[model samples]
Target chain A: MDLTTIVILALTGVLLLLSVIKDRRKTLAALRVAYKGFVRLLPSILAIILVVGLIIGFVPPKWIAQVIGKNSGALGVAIASLLGAVLFIPVIIAFPLARSMLDMGAGIMATAAFITTLTMVGFVFLPLEIKELGKRFAVARNALSFLAAVAIAVVIGVIIR
Target chain B: MNEKADAVANGKKRSMRERIRWDYTILFLLIPAFVALVVVFPDKGATARHVAWEYFKEMAMILPAVFIIMGLVSVWVEREFIVRFLGEGSGVKGVVLSFILGSIPMGPLYVAFPLAAVLLKKGAKVANIIIFLSAWACIKLPAELMEFQFLGWKFTLVRYLATLVVVVALSEVIGRVFFKQGYEVPDEALDGAEG
Candidate 1:
């Protein structure tokens, strides 16, 4: 297993063991909660998988690369961030996708913008966010996140490349 | 008829169940569509299936454990404890704690919404909650590891550092504008979100 998998598994193992040792009853309850939560997570996970398939099957990597490539400039970054906000691709898949785009010649700035907004500002989940966090907080957080993502992207582009 | 009002009266449980059902319908349709794609274009379908299968395997491995840890934390960390740490006058410790809590790699962003709502109701600073949500979205350790694997250490490290500064600044800026006196969370805010 890779470091990510190993570290995650180890962390879970240690924590679960501690919880079980500390209180068997609470541990059991926690297990039940975990199960239900996992179930809740399933639909989104499956949806992302479906999206991954579509992206791979239909969308050309080369086309994406051209749009967001090194010379694609500020327009590319804006487009990438907008697309990032619109889609709800989880980070698990987003990193791989970003890596692929980079390999296909996408600029560092564009990729950074894409990943930042992909994670931070999700318009696809805006309704749910608003439902839970309230209108003002949700809208402001999202709007601010888009700006923050761009700022972070620019910073990374300057420092790294 | 007031559809929105009717929805509130119907209660959140019904909507949550309906949403799950809706998700199932999509999954049901997508499976056949996926199969059809495989039939129509073998090469592309194989590539798509291959990629999907890889992520499915990855998520399956990590998610259960993540959920278990999240469950344990949620069950163990009392609301009062959260309020004490993140409530008014919490200061720098609260921000650091939020980042730590959020960086635990527990689950997806939507899963965080309910907890964020809970924090809001419990008198946590809205700005701190924003930091918590931003950290959950941006720099969870597992995600950072993945970024490192895919993008290398330089990109991962730079982005991680940059994201930290930006998230805190943005939250603070938005906090000043909207939560000058702190959040007054509405009743319906927690309707379906809180446990």
Candidate 2:
């Protein structure tokens, strides 16, 4: 791990210890709240994680490279955006994934869209979103993000394509 | 009037499942994650183990920190402070602040999600948090610097500019439309308007 991350981890540990030692009741309350939240979300998250595993199990990087790689145009941009709209992979994985896509010849525009939408949009998280934030906000945020993804992709496509 | 009423009635007739099936949020979130897993991680045993282990360690080390920080940020920070600094009325200043705050984020995107959730609960506007998290994931300062070393200044600048535009535009849209009734333009959000 990097120095920053290590530092943050150490701080977290210290804080947790302090919280536990100082106000055991509050600490326990917080732990309970956090655990309850985790339990509520667990089923859906686990299902999503399984689906993620399946995706990794099947699709090859070459296929992604073929669709969005260096020679791509409007179609490639659309495919990349669509792909992004459907996924919610962690940001940690996205960098190496994008790099590998680049290595396989994915165009910069497509890569940009893929990364942008991957984070912005939350298709599978909709249920959780609805449960947490309500339907209107969930719909609007996601819908706007989808359009924004396309617009961003096109803007990048124009500049780099 | 009849058509509108009919439309409302027709909509109400559908099951939550059916309505949810049409929810784009679910689909959009799933695809990129799916693509990442499919397109990124090696399928073979040894390579998969190496990649998984590395990522596992990184997440293992980072997640606890993320949870604690997120909790602290939520509990310690006041909603008014976040709104004044990054809320809608903060305008250009707010947007710039949000971008800077987002860009410096060091942990993973998932880490930001919980933080964003806490911020929302604490009264940070959805628009700002959306912009913050999205930008945090894409245009990380340290990560971008690393990329600059490999990808050149021109590419990085172009990407950064594009991302800024996208983040601002999308955040505004989300703020305007896609939120629940109670949270939509919360009364506290207007308190920052004059500032």
Candidate 3:
């Protein structure tokens, strides 16, 4: 395994061992709790993974890259912004995604927009957000976030371009 | 009967309008992106199968682990515990401690929220939790450092600033409207606090 994976595993192992040794009963109870927690997180995580896979499989990074690349201008930035909000690409995936987009020759503005929206906004998680925070709160928060994300994009575009 | 349905639809429309006003700038931004996509990129028809497969494969295992970890934190943990330990009322020291504590490792944004909710219910200050979560979700000091090494410091810094603003702002707003209404604090943060 890579160093990161190895470290994470080692850490998990150490934590697990410590918990077990400290109090076997508490450790067992914690494991049960953790298991239940795992179930709660399963659906979203799976959906996101599938969606990411589908996006990569279907959209062609080159096409995404082209739309967002350096020369593509404001239109490219808009598209990147939209995609960023809708897609759940985290910072980890963002690195490779941005690199691929760069390779595809996407403009700096588009890339900036993509990066901005990718983290700030969350179109896909709208329903869950609404459920959690009430519709008004979710809608307002996301709307504000989306705008803020775009503003960040615009600033980045200006600086980078 | 039809009038009632229409009224409900109208209410929905109004809500949508409010949301749209919040997002009008995105609409404006879209115009330029459309033009670029149409005019700039050539042969827009090609499919990117390999990249998708690679990303999918990598995330498959990782996501399950994240889910389980988040779930565990959610359950065995108590919200009041976190509030007592890290409430905003605790003052600057508490806020600073909250920030440091929050910046530690966690799961994805979506998974983190439910946990945040639990904390909110448990009595974590709306502002502190908001600040803590927003920064925790995005700033990720250690991880961001890695990103800077790879993607350049400028990108990382800009992202950090923007995300911080968004998180803090949203936290305040949510606190005023939702969490203050007596939502239950998350079990995990509470558990951590107690632990």
Error of 1 at A147 (Å): 2.0
- Model 2, span A12-74: residue lDDT tens: 778778777877766665555444444444444444544554544455556666667755567
TM-score: model 2 vs. ground truth: 0.70
| Candidate 3 lDDT tens digits, B1-195 | 999999988987896576445434443554454335434542331222343345455545344444334334444457566656766456666566656756766544554555455455456676676566555555565568666876678877776666556555655666567656644433332233232
Candidate 3 lDDT, A1-161, residue by residue in tens? 34534454565566667666777766666565556544534444444444454454446555666656645677777788898888776577676778678667776667766876676567766654543444554565566566666666666666665
CA error at residue B134 for candidate 2, angstroms: 1.1
Q: What TM-score does the first chain of candidate 3 have?
A: 0.69
The TM-score values for the models, in the order shown, are 0.72, 0.70, 0.63
For model 1, the docking class works out as: medium
Which structure among the candidates has the greatest TM-score? Answer: 1
Error of 3 at B68 (Å): 5.9
Q: Cα deviation of B159 in candidate 2 (Å)?
A: 1.2
The sequence of per-residue lDDT tens digits that candidate 1 reaches over residues A1-161 is 56767777898899999998999988888777667656765775687677667666666655555667654478879988987887667687789889888877778999999999989987756755765567888998898899998999999889977
Better of 2 and 3 by DockQ: 2
Interface RMSD of every predicted model, in angstroms: 4.8, 7.1, 8.4
Candidate 1 residue-wise lDDT at B95: 89
lDDT of 2 at B75: 44
lDDT of 3 at A5: 44
